[model samples]
Target: MGVFDSHKSFGKAILYTCSAESKDFFKVYESSDDKNVILSPLGVFTLLLLYAFGAEGQVADEIVEFLGAANKRHLTDSYRKLSRELSSMDPDLLAFSDNVYIDNQYSLNNSFILNAYSYNSEADIIDFRNPKSAAKTINEWVSTKTKGKINEIVSEDDITYDLVVGLYNVIFFKGHWAVPFDESETREHCFLTDDFQLIKKPMMHLLKSLDYFEDEGAGVRMIQLPYKESKFKMVVVLPSHLNGLSMVLRQISETGLLHYVNRMNHSEIVINLHLPRFEIKSEHDLKNILPKVGISSIFHGDAYGVVNEAPVSVDKAFQQAFVVVDEKGSTAGAATGLHITYTSLTPTIPFKVDRPFLFAILYDDIVLVAGTLSH
Candidate 1:
């Protein structure tokens, strides 16, 4: 799949809602004092969709509404197809995996098991009471799936006997730049933050012809740096004003994201790019954030259809993300876990990222991860 290929497999509503959810999640994550943040909204959505399959009543309704699906079947079919398509994507560029772990106390649903497999995923029955072993097993699974980029996703503290099920999602990506940066040109440069503080960092320099755009209306400079596979790229949005990151975040939406892609110019020109080599490792408790985006029912409401026994509600949901940007390429890994304890072308313009900014790693219309760099 080409980076600019049409997203015909996915519904427009899915794309819109996913991006909106990503932005909403970003809002919650940005409130944290730690400046650097990263999240895999797509991964989170997929896991929730899997939960929707086993959900009924208000739980089903809420998850369906938040996912922008007309019904549960619609959402499931769409996610099934999406899983197939994403798994079929070039592995060298991206890898995605999902797994479900249910406590042996409950009988697993055959349909749910089959559906998971159809999506190139699997399910397992584990003993939640044995928190130490269960946590280690879950962490090992995540580490193996993410090429060791992520680990300890579910600690002993996250496990309990009341926990009935757990869903896991991991997305790993490693793609080389279409035009690599010169290592010799990398130098120490001062990065100004929103608070007017400066920190010297190793800034990578590259002069190349790349997809570029300047959105005056949004007051941000957008640049697209494609990967060697041409199916993925890092789109950076740098606010024109040093302290304008909040403004850009306030104005960002699904429309804004599409605008970035639509407004991108393929015309290549000499660009003096100065991007800092940075590594961001972030962990977020999304339990509080999902409700803000119209997904409140699962936290406290009765969810009926998950199993044959009794009603269940999600207790813990979180995400851990890792991203590294440097002269060579970008490598990112994200894991979204649910504990049922029941849980460019840029132009040659001076594209120096010397301040707080936002970035999206995109594949077609789907936002694999959305993040902010305030430091």
Candidate 2:
């Protein structure tokens, strides 16, 4: 099926694919000490779509299959529509952007450049020989796009000499809660971790009408908290068992995130909500993780159609994400860079997120950010 068949289908594809990828990402960090993780699937998907536009041979085939696109044309056209929709939003509330930095030594295919323009993506030629300067320029652009939420996604060390093209995508969102939690009502509360450790954290409480659902078979409850004057929302999913985060994640991986999210269409009702004020910033080296999800060919010099002259392959792929949820609302931003490489609830009904849970920020059907809070 083509991604452009309908917006619902396209969004569902994105959510399913990205949610599975997020599950894989969490597996990579399962053994680590970090208790919180955040990343933008949309941002990373946009970057890959851009790369696929210029890809040919097996590289193009692999990415198209991974992205679930019927063809490159369908992929590019769908992204163009998605990009336009995102850009039409109030800039102060949300912003989306993409860029391609090509080395001066090589020129981009005219058709690829045209496709980039079709999506309003910026393409610039820079000197990759000067890794430090290139990194600074790219970092500045990303910082500006994300409004400083993400200061850097790439460093000089990431810019290798063999790098030919660097693809980047960024998304920024800041919205006030439709029914904001009163700051005065926020209090320190005990949060039980997955390991049964009780940690005190600032918890924001509010009683309001919100979309909520419970899946007894899944042992999870979900809630959707909307943002002021926007379709954007924060969906939180809490497990019935205190240490059931892994079980919930497995459900998402097996049934798809859209499956659970779509079931939240019941009705809005007033419920007691207890959400913790949290800020999570995470950085990932995607080279090691991408292969686990079947996107490994491009890194091995399989990508040659992007540049007009010299053959090039992705050398590195990185993503840096930051998110903050408090009494007022949430502010989240992420930057994904392919250094050539590249890469619920709730619930209303007395919903208390006192344990590890999963969450996502969505603009309509597209998931902008997804992660987990374990402590």
Whole-model lDDT, model 1: 0.77
lDDT for each residue of candidate 2 in 1-375, tens digit (9 for 90 to 100)? 223447454555577554563434455355346758887878777877888877787777777766767777777777887788887777788888889998888799887788888888999989989989998999899889888887778878878877788899889999899989999999999999878999999999999877788998889899999898567889999999888887877777666776887788555577798999999998877777777767777787455567777556677777888899998899998898887732202344798999999999987777888888887
Candidate 1 on 1-375: residue-level lDDT in tens? 432233333344444433343434455555567868888878778888887777788878877776666778777766766688789876656889898888888866776677778889878888888999889989999888788889789889888768888889999999799888899999999999768999998999988877788878778788888888756788888999889877776666545476667677778566788998889988888887787777777777765656667677788889899899988999988999876543304334788999999888877667787788888
Regions of candidate 2 where Cα sits further than 4 Å from its true position: 1-9, 21-33, 265-268, 341-348
Candidate 1 segments whose C-alpha is farther than 4 A from its true place? 1-23, 89-92, 342-347
TM-score of each: 0.92, 0.93
Which numbered prediction scores highest in lDDT against the true structure? Answer: 2
User: What lDDT does candidate 1 reach at residue 194?
Assistant: 65
Candidate 1 deviation (Cα RMSD): 3.7
Q: lDDT at 342 for candidate 2? A: 24
lDDT of 2 at 258: 69
